[model samples]
Target chain A: MTGRDRKLTRFLRIAAFSIGMIFVLLGVLRGEHLEVFAKAVRICLECIGIG
Target chain B: MSGMHRDRVETKDRPGLHERFRLLIQLASAALVNGYAAGFAGCKIFTGTSKMVCLPVLNCYSCPGALGACPIGSLQAVEGGAKHNISFYVLGTLMLFGVLFGRLICGFLCPFGLVQDLLGRIPARKLHVPEKIDKPLRYLKYVILAVLVILLPMLAVNQFGIAPPYFCKYICPAGTLEGGIPHLLMNESLRKTAGALWNWKLGILILVILGSVFVPRFFCRYLCPLGAFYSLFNRFSLFRMDLDKSKCVDCKSCENVCPMAVKVTEHINSPECIRCGKCKAVCPVDAISSRFETDMLTRNVAVKKVD
Candidate 1:
């Protein structure tokens, strides 16, 4: 609630938001969307340990 | 043990409007992600475009009803892939969730958390986990996150240079319940081929379900890697608990009511806190509040105005 604390919180918020946005951009670039789709569509029996 | 703590329960026997609304949101969120008609038949996993992104909760990706992928499962899959690539998308999404709401997801949105909450209402004599054992056991989830979810998948590769999602394969009661059981129930062919690993997972699922009846959120408190991951960001999450020391009565009522056994007065924004608002609800002096105060920019500094 002090002036210093308020400023610190503000700075931290900006920093956190910046980092989150960067990572999201990286995710779009790094994540293989087609592979994600492939994994999502089929039932991996190994996931449930049958096969 | 304090008089205020004892008095707190009687005064608020029935849930207030906010609590009712929270439960409603939790139910709706669960159904929204996993409401596919084909899910009931367990014949197919949804291959929709929505499945490309991860949901904040621990809903299994393999669940027939799941429209969104489980972040933990996706992270493991990404780690175990032939590329052995670290999933910035999954990590980033989870990080965003953590910084925004923290474990409020556990309290208000997770389908698995809803299961535990309903089971906790079974009227059984609650088994209070002693703080000595509980404190150390809390670290187990972090270890699981590091080892089973991350490290094992990254390290333990086969002849094809790919690894399996060890956590989902060996642990994850969510996958077992939402994916395994449903598939087995619907697909008669799978039941005939059910092996020891399947039985092992079933045992773990049964134990977690029974344990929830006696200890509220047993999996969350001790086993959920997702909760552990979210807990790390609780201190600085956008939506957070704030204790106005000026209004506090030293009554310890908040501590008494907290399901997570968080020492609220000691650490108002403790990482273990699920932001259930139970402490705020029970506070006789209106000292405790949950606020959405990120910065001066979007500061909604509404205090404990809940009735």
Candidate 2:
């Protein structure tokens, strides 16, 4: 029973920590890859047939 | 049968003061957003848009006379301005909002969310998006943020010698529809020169609006870069929902009320949650409540002792 409680608690901790960090990482990534992303957009737009 | 019905009636309690307060919060938030939109649209800030503090909510920066800047829009603008060798005042402003309120902006005060709520209220039946499709579609907003929001500006500078907000251009039904088309219709001068672009934007707005009638906050789920930014703050944000299992009556009222389909008992702080407070209001045994930073620590201690 105690082991179950500890495991559940550990799961919550990991879930909470990982979820929060995902956003922080995504936010950072957004600002980081501006140049590569911009070029990709142009090529993709042309492929699909619009500017 | 009648005796049993009256017995059930007596057992079912009426709503209390807390319920009233919750309803009041919803009414006030919706009114504030709608009133501001009407006022901004009218340029009658004294009456219409005057109540919108613009600090707690997201509003487009290029909006005709918008008093405040959208955090995401500002971020992109600042990034673009920097690439063009200009000061990133816009991005700086966005960072300040992100740090200050976090995702509380989404919970308490986005006019677009209010629009979704109103559309959801329409008499038409609510449509359920299948989990298979909904799950995958949720990621589209991020891709939009990555490519349309981030990538386009970077490329335009590197290759084309021009940079513009691509998300706003291609995908943002908000700016194109919310701020652009409506304002132009009101201004006769702007209408005369209206071209294919205006028509295209109007068509996009109409399609999104129709989709919204069937889908709950489809734009927030799919398109809004601002929502994308605020979601980053969901965890560290001081505001939170607390569950007290001590009451031990897992009635599941909170889970049933959540519009976002969040497993409220499990994912109390999910970014998908807009914090509408409906769950807290509906709990029959008062199992859920709102918590702020330090107070939540005390509650957690209390929760530890519950069993």
Index of the highest-lDDT prediction: 1
**Model 1: residue B70 alpha-carbon error in angstroms:** 0.6
Candidate 2 runs further than 4 Å off: A1-51, B1-56, B82-102, B158-161, B295-307
TM-score of each: 0.90, 0.67
lDDT per residue, candidate 1, B148-171, as tens digits? 998988888887778888888888
The TM-score obtained for chain B by all candidates, in the order given, is: 0.91, 0.75
Supply candidate 2's per-residue lDDT for B244: 70
lDDT, candidate 1, equals: 0.82
The number of clashing residue pairs in each candidate reads 0, 5
* Tens-digit per-residue lDDT, B104-159, candidate 2: 56655676666666676677866788889888887777777777666666665644
Q: What value does the lDDT take at residue B264 in candidate 1?
A: 90
| Best-fitting candidate, scored by DockQ | 1
